[model samples]
Target chain A: MKNMTMGLAALALLAVSGVAQGADDDHRLDDAWKAAVEDNEGVLSPAQVSGLNILAYESAVARLCDGIKLDEKKFAASVAAVVTGGSALSEEEQVQRLTAVMFQLGTANGLFLAEGAMKKDTFCAHAAEEKADKDNPHNWQ
Target chain B: MKFSRTGLACMLSFGLLALPPLHSPSHAGKTADAIAAGLVGAAIVAAASRHHKHHKRMYYDSYEPYPDNGYDTYWNNVYSPAAGITCYRAQVACYKANGHFSAKWTRMQFADGE
Candidate 1:
């Protein structure tokens, strides 16, 4: 009986370790994303970064709740316009700035999706409520 | 011993499966940057306006419009692309909501650009 109990305790330890490792992996990935953004910190202001992050999160929520679709060609044109509009920066600087902005946007979106996955019922409920709001752009009805 | 090993393997597999795919950095070429920039920029523009409107209702707050300087020349560039990014974001949300969490599915969403 003692041997059996030891085995069960061992199994529980292994399970807890597995969960810890998973969480560690998540933190590492998040750190890497932050580092990538920091690499181009010279390009975007803190406000711009904060604004972009919020924009990314809401966009993810809106997309999920609303049934809207993306148009690639038009999006490309718009980005080009924004990039070119900053004529003060050299081409290389412009590229770096754009890359940094994208990293911020992608990171926020991915984090939101992960949050939704982990808290699906609550997240979906909130999303649905947001969608139902008549003034929300996510509201197609 | 064998049963314990099997349980450990299963737990590890589950943990791996539960993780969302990491974002891969693409090489920043002019064309690719433009496309990627447009994709994210458009999304930002769309989400910014939408969020502004939403906030307005909740807090009666006003958002700053893009500056009226020369930057205004390209502000209009965002409209159509904003729609595209909004659609892409929606597609991603749909994928996640439906529980399609595979890395391949996530990559395909990015590749297909919708």
Candidate 2:
């Protein structure tokens, strides 16, 4: 009876710690996003910044969820079109701009995936709900 | 006539040389016409290839999913649940308004929503 009681207490402790850790991770992500916005202020438009966030979240879902696939080529082409101003920008300018945007996206994606890994069950549930929604555009197929 | 072998050879050579040159003015004109025709064909092919390439580039530029006309704010806002709409739906509306809907966009909208 004592051993069973001890086991239950340990499980409860672990569950509380997991919840606390998840909250901490969420805060970290929030701070990281705020920092990203501050760092890119004036350099990137608000839309571009928001696009990066959306891309990161979708990428995380795509990576961790089953039956979801990202069309990387099409996504990259669309991103290139936007960054290059519909191919109006010079090659050098496009390269510079794309590099910057990709770096930001990479950072955000890394953070999102790291956080998602910790609470995979919850994250994937949310991801599945989002994917099932007809109106969501990230298009994880 | 019983001509010698050497004499026969010389006559044949002279007879061959006496005929009109293969590149007569008329023949040269025909050759030039062929060359001109070939050039025109090549030019047409090149122009068609260029047009195809330009059309592809324009298609990408036109159909890509970037926000315009202040839709960027909407895009940013939709990420939050407070917006009461998913980003995907917002994007569909945005693309439709801007006439940027491609076949893929059309299919997605048809499969998912009105």
Candidate 3:
């Protein structure tokens, strides 16, 4: 009986450790994305850099939520789509993109992008899947 | 699609306005400076008016994002290609509305002439 109890505790510890390790793995994805942005040679104003950082961070979150299993094939396909479809925003799209990211993130959580925000439908139906920054990769943010 | 005559004209006028002024032969007199200022001012008003008129025609406030039916180097340099994204998944709204329009316009921005 004593040994069984010890085994259970050990299992719990392992599970908790797994969760922490998983979240840390997600951070690696975020860091890689940040590095990519920094690697980008495109000239940007301070404001633009800030905006891009927010977007990239949020986007990385979204991608993580979308799936952490990204390998070579998915990465290539996703890049092709964005490269092919992205608005290539004009000077104005910068503001709009930030706003959109906020809205999408806000709506995904039951509450807006503020405190007390939950995965409820008051904001949007797709909120359940958009957990971009919520430590959950399956969310809609 | 090609830039319409109106779009071309608008781009040219604004393009010139965006360019830096030519070096003055000499900055000796107030009159010379005023003349130069007037040229720039006229350019501003024309460009501003055109900007207003052009935007007024479309609902830019709710304007959707571009769809990438094709590719463009400039955009790639700016917004690097996505990881697994095949079509531009810009706005949830725009993509939900007309996925096709987004793609065509995207390619045009790249293929469209200067």
Candidate 4:
């Protein structure tokens, strides 16, 4: 019984550590994106950077929500916060948070399309899949 | 689209106004300097306007009626070889009332202009 309990605890620790490592990787990727964009001669201002970020968010949301009715003002505000807030949140987290907010807003306001228009994939999951596919590159456009 | 004659005249006037401050030293020159500053401001605005026109002009040639999960759509004529995206913004009220999704169009240049 003692050995079995110890084994279970060890397995739980391993699972927690794996989750932490995945989160750390996400933070690293976010940092890389930030470093690449910051001080880039092409970007005229921080607001432009924010605009690019919002465009990307829109692309992901379009796929996830399909024909769902989107609230533009709310979406823009959430994206602006992520861009200008200077928070240490990972890019993945930022996308997920925005998705959650939109989901709640859509549900409350009856913004979702008819039953047939919904998508099963989450924004974060879609992003991860895109990142892994080297043949299809991601960019501001 | 070609720049309008009015825009050209305005630009020329601004250019003329910008020249006097470079040579004259009279008290009227001070006023010319202010005019020159204003001309520079106006020139900047004019240039920005022209740039906006030069960018892409995307619109839906056709799209499926809204509440349809699939957007079977085609883009309007390509004004330039410049790359841009056409995304459908969900405005249920607009769609429900008018049978069209709000076209979220932007005139943007892709990196490498491809």
**What total of clashing residue pairs does each candidate reach?**
6, 3, 28, 0
- Residue-level lDDT of model 1, residues A33-102, one tens digit each, is 3333322332444344444443444445545644433233333332232222334545434443445555
- Cα lDDT for residue A113, model 4? 24
Of 2 and 3, which scores higher on DockQ?
A: 3
Ranking by TM-score: 2, 1, 4, 3
For model 1, which pairs clash?
A63-B90, A69-B87, A70-B84, A70-B87, A71-B84, A75-B81
lDDT (10s digit) by residue, model 2, range A19-126:
322222232343344344322232234355455545556666678877777666545543433343434534333333333455556666776677578767766766
Least accurate stretch of 10 residues (summed lDDT) in model 1 chain A?
Answer: A20-29
Stretches off by above 4 angstroms in model 2 are A1-28, A86-95, B1-114
After superposition, which runs of candidate 3 have C-alpha atoms over 4 Å from their true positions? A1-67, A85-141, B1-114
The local lDDT score (0 to 100) that residue A75 gets in candidate 3 is 29
Candidate 1, B1-114: lDDT as tens digits: 011323322322223122122234443344465445443544444344445533122111222334324222222121112211211221122222233222222233332322
Residue-by-residue lDDT tens digits, candidate 4, B10-93:
322222111221234564555444444332423332244335532111111221122222221111111212222222122111
- Mind giving the per-residue lDDT tens digits that candidate 3 earns over A29-126? 22222223221212222222232222232333333333322243332232222222114544233322222322222232211122112322322223
The C-alpha TM-scores of every prediction are: 0.34, 0.42, 0.18, 0.21
Report the CAPRI category for model 4: incorrect
Docking class of 3: incorrect
lDDT of 2 at B32: 47
Q: What is the TM-score of chain B in candidate 3?
A: 0.17
TM-score of chain B only, all predictions?
Answer: 0.18, 0.19, 0.17, 0.17
Summarize candidate 2's per-residue lDDT along B25-90 as a digit string, tens digits.
876565444334332423332244334533222122222222224333322432211122122332
